[model samples]
Target: MPSPSPILLAPMEGLLDFVLRDVLTRIGGVDRCVSEFIRITGTVLPDRVFLRYVPELLNGSRTPAGTPVRPQLLGSDAACLADNAAALARLQPEGVDLNFGCPANIVNRHGGGAALLDTPEALFDIVRAVRAAVPAHLPVSAKMRLGVRDASLALENARALAEAGACELVVHARTKTDGYRPPAYWELIAAIREAVAIPVVANGEIWTVADAQRCRELSGCQALMLGRGAVADPGLAWAIRAADGQAVSGAVGWTELLPQLDAFWRIISHHFPGRQRVGRLKQWLNLLRRRHPEAEAAFMEIRTLTDPAAVDAWMARQRA
Candidate 1:
């Protein structure tokens, strides 16, 4: 093929924060990373909040490893979003991403995230406003689900975002109601790709290289964004890239990943408290276990441990 194509790290709230983004993107093959959703409420949030969400904005909008970080905004009010986008633009992000795809009940109840799918006009207006507010050089992208309850508005929603000047869009290939059920409906992305002229990135249900190839063929989307799968298999992007092109024999096995795990623990413990670090490490370890037998064995060793120091010691032993 013409090249493996660009892979983006999805903005998964709570899970893929700056720390995770820093660790994961460092593995390579990921072109860019979007920040955890910056919750825009009734008014424009201050710069500190944006900085808190995307610390990389201060570092040339890049991870320590050099992957560009795009800040994602989530909310319903067009004016509030636009105003916040303007403030974010001042901070010089690579781009501003709008989140219309989050399925969290808390987000929807607060008139943010997938709730906007119910009112396509509001989604359009929000995009239009943010697009107008940000500098012309900066890109304005959007992420959305197929629809709220069904695929009924998929085309309309895609068209609305494209018409409102979303230079690129990422479709999660499922309705808000699907809530990550089996079968990500990759075919739905094809209709979205056809509906909009801007680049349509296919997301959801891509857990392996084979799945990536199938998603590319099925969605007809050159760009693919990875979420949980990337977390579970840190070397997945490299493996996928190698499968299509030059061989990348980097960090595939669990033993090979121990150093990375230790690096993550040392980096995160500097900021997160012992209990929070314990929880975060386990959260990642749980996801990691899905792909690596080593992670499963490691999790079993630390599953009941509530102290970060104990967890650190366990990881040190693994390294030894």
Candidate 2:
């Protein structure tokens, strides 16, 4: 039988930085990850910015756990995006991804991100320019929503990206206006798959192994990307693999999970200090609470704490 479709860790800005990417991919079953976009604005970004967003690039573009990391760029100017893509390419990243799907009001208002979806021609131009700028061998991809305000242009946008030389496409299954409200319109993905020649990866609202199977069946996609769900349940991808008749990895209970949390704390502490690190931990725990009642209780205990080392002590006590 053919290998099971790969499960990718979706890029959630402000949340899925190198620390989370390393931690989650280390848990197993993630095939790869995309960096939280590096905004191109009107000029090429400095090299340090790329390094900061995707440090793995310096180490062969793979996370410490060995999953490949694709560096993504977001901007509206075709030439500018292409320029930045070329600069990122020089870093020898595993791949390049273009972002046409950010839903933040600030991004859209600035004529970047999902705003480009309003004009498919602009999307095609940007992707085409970047495609031509990068060498032929490197795989280029795009991630987009159904549309800015509706799903009317879903197929057109998908076609635009493919025709522009995007090797793969990931559809978030919601309109920009939908803003993650769910019922991800998986059916629309099937139509998009039919319209595009390249591979389609389904994303959005996938919360369980059952959900993953249902998304594959409904969207006719060959691969899947997990965002909040992966953060909530780190074992989600492995569970999906096991359900597909693959060998199962061991499960992670709260006891096993606490160490991973501690690892995350240590990783963040290396970069952030004091209350900043504690705040980052709270952000992760808030997401983890969805899957682990233990996380919810732990969050309540540390949510008000201000010191980073103090929070680490609390976690160490729990682990003990």
Candidate 3:
């Protein structure tokens, strides 16, 4: 039988950075991860910029837990993106991912991200350029939404990326206008899968093992990518694997999750400055509250404190 599909961690810009990737991958069950989009605008960014966004590049492009990370690039200029991809390739990332799926207005307004979804020809050019620039052994992939305003051009866009030599395609089952609302249209991914020859991974709104199973059923995709859902419950990937009869542990209860939270705090404290530290903890606690009641209480307790030392003391108390 074919091997079970891999569970990938989505590259959530601003939310899933290297620190969180370290924590979650340490929790186990993720097969691979895509780093947040490194915007390639007009110029070829310096090595520091790529290393800043994905420090894993310094460690052989693998997280502290040893999971390979593919750095994703977002842009509209085919030549500039190609140049940036070449620079990033020299850093030896596991792979390079092209982002055609970000829906942020700031990104769209600049004619990047999901804005390229409106033009299949642009998608073709961008992916083709990046693919040609990177070494043949290194994989080049693309992630895209169903379309911009609607699904009318979804198939065309998928075909363009596939024809342009994208090794794999991740379809985030919603149009640009759909935003993050419910009902991620997994069935639409099925159509995109049918249109493309490469592996199509389904993404969007998969919060639990049940959602994962249902998405697999509807999209006819074996692979699923987790985003906010994984952030809320770091063990979601492990739980999904266990549900599939893999010899793995299941859900990480609040008590079991505390250690990982502590680790997350410790890393951010060392890497981020005092001013940004507490907000990073709060940002995660806000999402953790979605899955754990204890996190709600923790969030409320530290919600008012701007002092990093106060947050540190509070964390120490929790560990106690």
* TM-score winner, 2 or 3: 3
lDDT of 2 by residue, 271-309 (tens): 887888888999989989998999999999998899766
TM-score ranking, best first: 3, 2, 1
Query: Which number leads on TM-score?
Result: 3
Model 1 agreement with the true structure over 157-179: per-residue lDDT tens digits = 99999999999999999999998
Compute the lDDT for candidate 3.
Answer: 0.93
Candidate 2 clash figure, as a count: 0
lDDT of 3 by residue, 99-196 (tens): 99999999999999999998999999999999999999999999999899999999999999999999999999988999999989998898889888
Choose the strongest candidate by lDDT: 3
The lowest-lDDT stretch of 10 consecutive residues in candidate 1 is 1-10
Error of 2 at 319 (Å): 3.5
Give the RMSD in angstroms, all C-alphas superposed, for model 1: 1.7
**Scored by CA lDDT, what does every candidate get?**
0.90, 0.89, 0.93
All candidates in order of lDDT, best leading: 3, 1, 2
